[model samples]
Target: MCNEGCLIADLELTFTVKGSHEGSQKILLDSDPSLRIIVFHCVINEQTRLDVTLPEELADGNETVKSGVLSFPLNSLPVQKEIIVEEEAGVVNKYNNRKIIANLSGDLDVRLGFNLCMEEQEFLRKRKKYVAAALKKILHLEEDLKEHEVPVVAITTTGGGTRSLTAMYGSLLGLQKLNLLDCISYIGGLSGTTWTMANLYEDANWSQKYLEDAIKEARKQVTKSKICCFSLDCLKYYYEDLKERTKEGHNTSFIDLWGLVIESMLHDKKDEHRLSDQRQTVDNGQNPLPIYVAINLKSGYSAQAFREWLEFTPYEVGLLKYGASIRAEHFGSEFFMGRLVKRLSETRICYMQGMWSSIFSIDVMYVWNLAADSEDFWCRWTRDRVTDIAEEPFLSMNPYEVDTCLFTPSSVLSSALRDVLTGRPTIAQYPNFIRGFQMHSKYLESEGFSTWKDTVIDSFPNKLMETADDELSLVDTGFFINTSYPPLLRSKREVDVILHLNYSGGSQTLPLDQIAKYISGQGIPFPKIEISEEDRENLKECYVFEDADSPQAPTVLFFPLVNDTFKKYKAPGVERTPEEMAEGKVDVSTILSPFTTREVCFSEENFDKLVKLTDYNVLNNEKLIIRALRLAVARRKQRKY
Candidate 1:
C-alpha cells in the first residue's frame, strides 16, 4: 500500500548473515526468485538522509566487524539524489525471467550501494562451509537430541552484526547455494494474541501473508454465501485443503476465526469508515487494546502482581504500540484440573475446533502451571495492576505469546485438526506404549528418536519436604513434596511405580552411605549406584548451594513421593548478574526465573509414561479416561474379534 509523492526514507540497515557459502565472501543472490526489495528515502519530520558505507573487518579469516555508520544531517531541506545502482544486473538465466523493477514512490527514490572487500576473501571462500555446518548442527540437534529440540528459532538484533540480516540472509543464501530452496518450505504462524490488529511487528511478511490468506478465505466464503453455514461443510473442506497444503497437517493445524471476523468487518465499508474515524480520534496517541492472560494460581503471582510485572517488562510498551491491552487470569490452585474442566465445558461457547480450542485452553493451564511451579517468583514487582482477575474476554485477547509458546492463526488451525483427528484431548498428552517409564526409555534410546531423547533420564537428586514441627534434615532417601502426598500415593498404587521428586540443592544433606543404600535398593541396577570417594567429590559439585556456577544449568528439584510439606528456598539478598537473567542472551522476567528449569525432570521413558498414565488422570477429565479406556477396548476387540 503505497501513495504518490510519498517521501521514501533512505535508511542504512545493517545485520549479520548467519549462514555460509562454499567460496568467496561476496553477498550472494538466489538463482530464481522474485526480488521485492523496497529501499525507501524519506524525511520523517525534517530528518536529513545521508548515504554512507561502512568497511567490514575480518578476524582470522572470519568477518568480525561491519564498517560504515549513517549519520543524518541536522538541516531540513528538499534533498535530491541520483538513482545510482539501478542498472547493476546480475548473471541472468533466460529461463528464469527475473525482473528487478525500479519504481519511484512518494517523496523518495531508492537505489542499492554495494561495497566489496578482498580482506575477507578466504573467509568468504569457506562461508558456505560455516553456514552449512551451523544449519547441519541445528537440524541434527532438532531431530536427534531429545533434550534440546528447538521448538522456535527467533531471529533478532540483526542490523548491528558484521553480516547484516545475518540469520535471514544466511538461511536464504544457504538454500540457494545448496539448491534446496525449492525442496524446503518456509512456514509462517501468525498470532493475534494481542488485543488489536494494528499493533504487530511488520518486519516479516509472514504476518501479512497470513492476513492475506485469511482475506482470501473470507472472500471465498462470502462470495459463496457459505459464511452462515453451521453444518461445518465449509470447515471440513477448509481443513482438507489445509492438510494438502501443509506438511505437518497430519498432526497439527490452527485457525483464527477472530481474524476472519476482522476481515468480515473490513469487508463491510461501514465498519471500515468507523475504524478510520476511530483512528483519527486519537488526540495524544492510539490507546492500547486489551490483552488477556490466564495463569494457574500455583505460579505464586496474584492477578494484581502479574499485571505489575507486565508493566515492568519491555514488551509492555512494545505491545501497546501494536494496539494491545493486558489482563491476567489466575486459575486458582488446581492448575491442570481447573484447565481441563474449563476447556471441556467452554469449548462450545468459544466456537473453536480441535487445535484452536486445545491451544487456547491448554496454554492457559500449562503456562499457569509452569508459573506456579517456579520458585521465588514475585508477580507484583513492577507497577500497579491496571485490571484485575480474568476480566477480558477470550475473543478480545485474540493473539498472544507467552515466552516462546506462540498461538497464531495458522498454528491454531493445524492444532485443531490434529486434536480432533488424533482423538487427543491435549497436545501435551503422550501415548502409553511405554510400560510406566521403562518402555519410554527404550523408545528414546533408539537411534531414530534424536538427541533430545537423552533428556528423559532422571539423574538429579530429589528433595523431601517436612512439616513445620519436623526437624529439617537431608536424607539420601528420595521423598515427595508435601502437597503431592495424596496424588503420589495414588499414582504409586495405580501404576506400581516409586516416585523420585525434589530439589537437587537439598541432596547434599543426605549422607553418602544412605544414598548408596538407597541406590542398592534399586534392584538390577549397575555399580554406578555404589558411590565411591571420587563419586562423592563429583556429587558435591552437583549438590545445591547458592554459589553453584554450572553455566546454563538449571537448578532442579525432584520428588519420589508426593507430599505437601516442601521447603521453599528464598533467593538470598543478592542481585542476579546480567548473565543470570538472560536465558542464552534472551531476557526473561525474574518473576519467571524459577520455572526456567530448562531440563526435563524425568527420563523420557518416565515422562511419557507419566503423561500417559498419570497426566491423563491428573491433568485430564474423568470422561477422557472413560473414552480412552473404551478406545483401547475397541482396539483390542478389533484385533481379537
Candidate 2:
C-alpha cells in the first residue's frame, strides 16, 4: 500500500451528543480520521444507535478500519430539559413560571383586558390586610370591621411639570402626617407627579420621616441652576452616558438627554438608578404599590385616539391595552415573538422619568428664555439696551404663542448644532423606542391578536396595526389622560375608591371627565362624572362622583388645586404682586402654567407656600377623604351580602 493510504492507521473518532429527546452517545472509528456520523430522530423513551461510517477517501484506503455502534438511553436525560419542553408547550406547572409564559404575558393579546400580574395579586393581598389594620386604628372602626369589608383604594396624582411635583410631595406628606398613607393600597402618578414618587421611593423608608427630609432636599435642588442643557460639564456627562447606551444597542434620542437633565435637577448628581431597583422600596410590603404611567405613540395620534397606557411597577412593566407584562428587570431587553431575543440590562429609572415628563418638545433655548422671561429676569437683562432690538421678540410670547417660532426647521438645525457642541440632544420627539414581536397575519388572526374584532383586520387604519412593523414608539401618558387611572382600574385590582388629584391647568373636571369618557369607551367601569354647570363654573377644592346604576364602579374623590378654597388672597389667573409673594402666598400663575422652567430658583417662602397650599388642600378636605373611604367600605359590604 502507498504511504498516503496508510497515513491515518492509528486515528480514532468519537462522537458525543446530549439532549432530553435524544441522549448522550459515543462512537468509535478505528484507523481512520476522516469519517461521517449520522443520527436520526429517535422515538420517545427509546434507545437510538449512532451510525458511524468512513468517508469516501477513507473507504478507498488500503488499510482496514474498525467500526463500533453507540446506543443512548433517552429516559435518563436531564429533568431540566423536560421542564423546558413543557414550558415550550405552553403548560406552566409552577406558579413561578406564570410570569414568563409568552401566550399569557405577550403584548399581542389585545382581547385580554387589564389584569394584575401574579406577583401584583399576591402583593395586593398583603397590602389589603395592612390597610384594613391601619384603617381600623385610624377610623376607630375596629368593631365595624367584622361586619364590613376593607376597600381597595387607589390615589392618583396629576401632571403639571415641576410645580405639580412639589405639590404632590406636600400632599403625600400631609397624608403621612394624618396616618392615612398606610391605608392607601396603590399610588399612581403621571408626569410631574411621578417625579415626587420617584424621589420618595429612592428610600425604602420613604413613608416615614425620610419623606420630609427628601422633600426639603428636593426643594433646594429644584431652586438651583435649571439649565443643565447649557452646562458644558453636565452636557459632557450626558454625552458619554448616552454614547455608552448607544453602544449597548439602544437607540439614543432627545429623551435620553432630557433624562440626564432631570437626573441633574432631581438628584443633583448622575443617575445610576435602575427601574428594577425600586423593588426594594415595596419589598416586605413596606410601601403602597407604585405605578408610573406612559403612553404608546403612533403617527398622528391624539388623546381621543385608541390610546394604550403602559404601566410601570416595581415588579413588571407592560401595556394595559394588551394585558401583557414582563418583569421590570427585562424592560429594555431585546424581545421578539413574545420572548427575549437578547438579554439586556434593565433601563435606568432616569430614562423612565424622562419619558413620564416628556410633554415638552420645543427647543431648549426657547424653554430657557421662556422661564427667564416669566420670572422677569429676561426683561431686566434688556432694560439698559437700545429700545429697537433690546427685547427678543420671542421673550414676550407664551408657550403656545411661540410654537410657530420655536418648532421650525431652522430651530431644529440650531438644536442639532447645540447638540453637536454640547453633546446632548435637548429636544425630544418621542419618549422611547419599543421592541416587539413580528407575527404573520394568519398567526395573529388565529391567536385573536388582530386590532379589529371582526375579519376586517386587513383594513385596519393605524399603520401600527399592520404586521409590517415589529416595534412601537411610546411617549408620555400626559398626552392621553394625563392623570394615571388605567393601572388602578384594572379588573383584577377591583379598586372601590380612587382619589383623583387634579393639578392640570385645564378645567377642574378635565382629568376626571377625560378618564370617565375613555374608560366608558373601553367598557371599563368607572363612576359617571356628572358635574353640574354650577360646579364647573365655580370649581371647589374637592368633589365626589358616584355611579348609582353600577355598584362595581369605583367612587371618585376629585380634588382640584384651586386658590379660592385655601389661599383666597392668591387669585386665579392673576399674577401675585411681589409684596403678596413675600407675604407667603404662592402665585398660582407661576405654578400652574405648562411652562417647564418657571421658578427655577424658588425662594424659601415660595417653596413653603407651594407645600402649604398643597397640604391645606388635602387637610381642608379630610371629611371628603374619610367619606370616600366609608362609601367604598359600604359598597364592599353591599357586594358581599
Q: Counting only residues 3 or more apart in sequence or on different chains, how many pairs clash (N, Cα, C under 3 Å) in candidate 2?
A: 0
For this target, which candidate reaches the highest TM-score against the unseen true structure? 2
In model 2, what are the clashing residue pairs, if there are any? none
- TM-score of each model, paired residue for residue: 0.17, 0.69
Q: In order, what lDDT does every prediction score? A: 0.22, 0.61
- Runs off by more than 4 Å, candidate 2: 1-114, 144-148, 300-303, 361-363, 368-465, 568-584, 589-601
Q: Summarize candidate 1's per-residue lDDT along 305-340 as a digit string, tens digits.
A: 221101101011101111111111111011110121
lDDT of 1 at 328: 16
Model 2, span 1-641: residue lDDT tens: 00001111222323332221223333333523443232322222354222222222333246633333333333443322312121222212231121100112123311123456667877776677678877787777856454238788889988877778778877887777777888888999887788788888888868756467888888887676665444546645776787788787766677776766677777767767777788887766668889998776555545455455678899888765445677787776654334454566677888878778777433434555654446343332322223322245745455444333222232333344345434533223321213333234553443223321222222353444443334456666766667888778776678888888877765667777877876786567777777789878777778888887898888888877765545443432444566666543445644453323333446666677777777777777787888888777777777855
Error of 1 at 270 (Å): 15
> Candidate 2, after superposition: displacement of residue 270 in Å?
1.2
